[model samples]
Target: ENGEFKPAYNDTIKDYNTILEMFDRILNPDPMSYTSPELKSVFSKFKDLFEKHYEEQKELENSYQVQSNTSTQAIKAKLS
Candidate 1:
């Protein structure tokens, strides 16, 4: 069932968020450093990249779900 896929997808999202947070911390280091426009620019770029990849992943997941549903319907139709 589709419900079974949710837990795994949620876990993946949690892990991805954690990793991004860790990277942000590593890149920014301190609040004072965040005051620097250069540091802010770099971190912003990193964040943009993270969001791009996250969106791509979500699109891929949606495509897979559509394919799965279509296949399941086909199988059910064949059975009945």
Candidate 2:
């Protein structure tokens, strides 16, 4: 329950987008001079993990879209 950043693998797309936006703010704070080296290092790790999750989810969505479109086209062809 710690407010630590972790990948929300099963979360909906909207939730994932919200987490990404928050993480972006955390990784790039307005006053960059105030962040400690250790904190920065930790945030960097979070960024890497989050980026991987984002990419994986993006690929899945793209494949699903392709499949949906193909199915729709096949249905249309059969109907016509």
Q: Residues 1-80, candidate 2, lDDT per residue (tens digit)?
A: 59887754555665666777766666666674366678878988987898898899999999999999999999999999
Report residue 46 deviation for candidate 1 (angstroms): 0.5
- TM per candidate: 0.58, 0.57
lDDT of each: 0.76, 0.78
Model 1 bad stretches (over 4 Å): 1-34
Model 1, range 1-80, lDDT digits (tens) per residue? Answer: 85555422345446777767766765666655444668667777888898899999999999999999999999999999
lDDT of 2: 0.78
